[model samples]
Target: MRPNPDAQSPGPCEAAPARKGGERPSRRLLLGLLGSTGMLAALPAAGQAPTSAPKASFGYADVVERARQLGERPFDADAARIPESLSQLSYDSYREIRLRRDKAFWRDGGSDFRLLPFHLGFLHDKPVQLHSVANGVALPIPFTTALFEYGKVPVPKGLSPSLGFAGFAVTTTLNHPTVQDEVISFLGASYFRLIGRGQRYGLSARSLALDIGGAYPEEFPFMRALWLEEPAPDATELVIYALLDSPSVAGAYRYVVRPGPTTHVDVTATIVPRKVIERIGIAPLTSMFQAGEGDLAQRSDFRPEIHDSDGLMMQAGSGEWIWRPLRNPRSLRIASFVDENPRGFGLMQRDRDFGNYQDLEAHYHARPGYWVEPQGEWGKGRIELIEIPTDNEAFDNIGACWTPEAPLPVGEASEFRYSLSALSTTGPLHPYAQTQHSFAGSDLEDGHAQGQGSKRFIVDFAGGDLAYHLGDPARVELAVSVTAGSVMTRILQPNPAAGGFRAIVDASLPDGQTGEMRIFLRARGRTLSETWTSSWTAPAAAAPPQPSE
Candidate 1:
């Protein structure tokens, strides 16, 4: 999401200021910047370049040194020279400035990819330095209004052609050989979005998440500068280098992006903090979850469901796979799953049926899920999911990121490496049956549906061996456990609607009691599904179970 132009300037990891009621930017106006493009013959000839190389030789090491040096000194917010006119442009006026495709960075030097810079305006008041690296030399990409087509807004008179660009997007022929598609974009502080062969932009990935869901206001780190390595004419992978800056930390990042059926980005981050950070999040994911089928009673919309992601999936250190269904809670809720050397985790949109969304324009069903696989053993941390209440679909209220257990020491470098996979679903990891849907309702007590005494949980599991044992409920067993109160009844039966087996759990809790429950399916001494877990809380003033008389 783009930052609010009037919001306080902070790090990208910080919680962004809430967008208020206004004529917000249109989806097409925001994403239409990147579209189909023809192939580039090659990188432009060196002699024809507009500017010479910078003093420092271009490489990953150079970026790391720059970040370290910057951290040693006090943070400077005004590093880039942005024009006052661009820094004060409104949302509608900013969108009017569109990049010219023919003047793209790698326009016809002979590469399979091209780069177009984002204009600095609206929420992007802070401009970032962009450079093109070729033959071990990094040359700056000078910004000019001539590169943009001001649709309705007039360009400011005497506008400098050297104002730094805000960010950039890359166009490539990953899916189609001749037709170029915008596969990845970098904008809005440290936020970036990536799409695979057939996926559209949905959730976003951040370089880091700092003090999110904490008592104090969060901080947002920004990518101040970036270097794009010139790719060969037949190169399949693109390498990018970035310098991250914030009031609390400074860092360098390298991303090796490979676009394919499941686009994979190998990331290496080296961070050094100016002050001690009590809580820092790594590999953060931001998404939206307005409503789903399980919460249909709470929604009054015509669409069956509306969300970018439906659940949070994690692989714990003990090799246990856990799936927690996401909800648009009535209030802010933060849940943490502690682990050491976690296998992986992600926010997934498992429900792919188009009918689930029914919106032809948004195509929410086609949103891609991003799973992060850590490259090395992270000592101890917690995967935290923060869900905030939101009534509309435009706001992103779901945030998932890994918080380190140990405090970050000042003036010391901390490093982490990971790879991200953009996929349709997280089905390959857990070959066993997986939970399809989960919902809660009033339980039937003595032929009466009692809403206060007992609660019923319905969980459906599909795929894997469940397909082999269809209609054979006798072969399936439900294993249930609870932290408090007792699981009075449990049953397993085939669900024709889900094309799988459904497990039902009915439990009774004492007043003022909250219980944590776990459920899974077992058939003939073999586990058949990933664990379904939830934290259930009873109403504060609910009456206790009455004595049988």
Candidate 2:
């Protein structure tokens, strides 16, 4: 489903500071700055032509050297310099500023990709330097208001022509040969969003995550600069290099973006820590989950399910596939799955039925899921999932990433490489059966006594060899295990409607305790489905009825 072009909501990251009169910028406003031919026809080209090239040749190694040098110096918290007028603009005023399509970089160069720069204002106070690299020569793209059409926004006086840009978006002939559709964007801090054919914006990917879900305050790293390599007229891929900076670390990144049915981004990241970093997240993915099948009773909304992602999928180094359903927890919750030489992990939106989410404007079903496949051996790390409490769907409260066991050494560069794919289906990747749906509630309706602190769960397993065993349902068995609870009962039954098998389990846990439950299907000692894992917290027994009242 394509998202409404004018919808207003917070992005996948933290909400930006409120604008004047307490209004905030919408996610659409932040990610949807596409250029229009009608608006550009009357505007003139802005900024000066390319300046003289730098003395040395430009390449990925150059960006690494720059990052290393940057780590040696004190971190600059004031690098982004914006005039008060631009910084103080309201959300409505900021949305009025649009880039001119006729003046877009590489528009007349016969290249398949056109780069549009974002104007700095509102929540995007940080300015990132952009450069066009061609023939080993990197030329800086200067900033100018002449490239923008300020609708009703008043032009600020004495604006600097060297103020630089907030970030940029790349457009190509993705859906049609004559029309350009925005395939990717890099804006805000180190956050970026991508879409494939017939997909809409949903989650976001970050360059690096520091001290996330730790005791201390989390540190956000920003992209200080980007070098876009000029693409060949017939090029099928676009290469980009980025410099990342934060108080704890400085890093360099290279992205090879290929747009197709499933857009894939090949990423190479190298970081040098200024100090010993205890917690660092690699290939971090951020998303939103307000409510889903498991928590339908908790939601009062009209839509059945409203979320960008429904579950977390992982392939551990030990060749075990796991699926953990996401939730909007009552409090902050962090779950870790340890592994070595991990294969892949991602946040997936498996429920594609539009009826599940009746909101046509949001198009939650069309949101793409991103899978991270590690390129080489990443020894001794764990995939961490952090779910925060949120009452509204506007805020992003889901985060997943890989955290290494050892702290990064000071002043030493650490390198990691991975491929991220924005896809919709997981059948091609998973060999075993997968979890189709899951629900948890009390077991009263099943005639089982409402035992104190007991909860019942129903999990459906589909696909894979489950179809072959449908004729003989007695051969399948349900395996259940728990970390801090006791399984009272377990039953496996054939689900002819779904061409799968359903497992029902009743478990008991101590009051106020949280436990992890793992379930799977097996036949003749052969595992048939991915492990379904979930965390359940038993509600504390109600205060003894307050007899005095």
Alpha-carbon lDDT, every model: 0.77, 0.81
Residue 456 alpha-carbon offset, candidate 1, angstroms: 1.7
How does candidate 2 fare on TM-score? 0.92
Q: Model 2, stretches more than 4 Å misplaced?
A: 1-16, 19-53, 442-452, 542-549
Please, what are the lDDT tens digits per residue for candidate 2 over residues 35-68?
Answer: 2222221112434456553845799999999999
Off by over 4 Å in 1: 1-22, 25-57, 159-162, 442-453, 496-499, 542-549
Global lDDT of model 1: 0.77
- TM-scores, one per candidate: 0.89, 0.92
170-204, model 1: which lDDT tens digit per residue? 98886798977778878766778788888877777
Residue pairs clashing in model 2 are: none
Model 1 lDDT, residue 132, Cα = 86
Model 2 CA lDDT for position 242: 96
